[model samples]
Target: ARATVRNARALAQALHDRGFDVLAADLGFTRSHTLAVRVEREGGGESVAQRLAAVGVIANKNLLPGDTSPKHPGGIRIGTPEVTRLGMGEREMVRVAEILDDLLHRGKPPEAVAAEVAELKAGFTTLRYCFAAGEAAYRYYDLVGRDPP
Candidate 1:
């Protein structure tokens, strides 16, 4: 609870530091992953993820209708998973936000982005996504007469 309060305060400070217009947060999720950020858009120059990163907040932006990238829309989806995998704590999550922001908004080349993606993946390789495992999980669920696993 103490850590949550601290992080919350830091997030608020960070948003204020970045000049976000509105910065309300969600509290239902057990972790920061559920947080949402809204910033005043400026002539296609400002973006939600950029604001969050300025304040060291990592978040996911939902795809605009029909958009289909891990990042879309104007939302930043952040969580503790990657930090935990990187052997980091809450503070590191804040730092990770910097890396995320740079990659997303800077329009860095795909190869450079892919390399960072690989590092992040290496941190949590267990869920690296395996086709065989997916098929098996699907089969198990199907055996129980469930929808696609």
Candidate 2:
């Protein structure tokens, strides 16, 4: 939980540094909810996630209005522990951190993220037993599966 919070804070700070108005708030009124981010915009062209990503924030869709815990909610949690297990160093962690912000904020199209997710799965050579690659694929799958348009 601490690690997740740290990741969230780091992501928020990165976004703020990159010219993004970061919203530091909890979402969903549940124990296992999540932290949320709302990237303020002007013309309203990009999706909230996309706008946030443009700067560096990765807003989890599960986040409602006030929640914390990635175990089973909207907050997308990123932890360095897994990368560390995979033999990734600080620099790699930073890069993965950047990727987290990108994956969340980019509001990647289902197809695009899906492709990325596939590549990520293929890259999971460490059998280090992490969840990001798989979770990413599942999330993208769910998103694509629920496409209403």
Candidate 3:
């Protein structure tokens, strides 16, 4: 729980530092393992979420304050439990933020960002505290799933 919160806070701060407009700056970004980011400039939550997904970042678009519809949200919610379970810490959170910045703010190509994301994901394929590690976890990158042991 502690680690999850720590990483989530780190991620929120990093995202904010990149001028991403992370929600809840007064509440320390988040107290749990998740945070919300408003992407009004990048075409709202739904569009930005889809762009992030194109580069392999998994996040859900949800309606923010004053937003009327869930289908077209104004914010994207991100969580850190999966990466934290894979042994990611504050440093990796910063890396995640950098990737987001590059894609969202710096105008990097989706293909390039996808390769960078794949590289970052490759480092965490081996999950800690698990006997089967990569085999046990869902292969979210290439969609290659193992049947069973």
Winning candidate number (lDDT): 3
* Tens-digit lDDT string for candidate 1 (1-149): 34444454454434434443223534322344234344224211136555444433455554333334433354433444333433344554444444444544455554665566456544432322334432322355666877730
Tens-digit per-residue lDDT, 55-112, candidate 3: 8999998789988887788999999988888888999999999999999999999999
Q: Which 10 consecutive residues of model 3 have the lowest summed lDDT?
A: 140-149
- Those runs of model 2 whose alpha carbons end farther than 4 Å from true positions after fitting are 25-34, 42-46, 50-149
Residue pairs whose backbone atoms clash in candidate 3: none
Per-residue CA lDDT of candidate 2, range 95-138, in tens?
Answer: 44455444445555545554544454355435243455433323
Segments of candidate 1 deviating more than 4 angstroms: 1-22, 25-33, 39-73, 81-87, 124-149
Name the lDDT of candidate 1: 0.42
Regarding lDDT, does 2 or 3 come out ahead? 3
Error of model 3, residue 2, in angstroms? 1.0
- Ranked candidates (lDDT, high to low): 3, 1, 2
* Candidate lDDT values, in order: 0.42, 0.41, 0.87
TM-score winner: 3
Least accurate stretch of 10 residues (summed lDDT) in model 2? Answer: 25-34
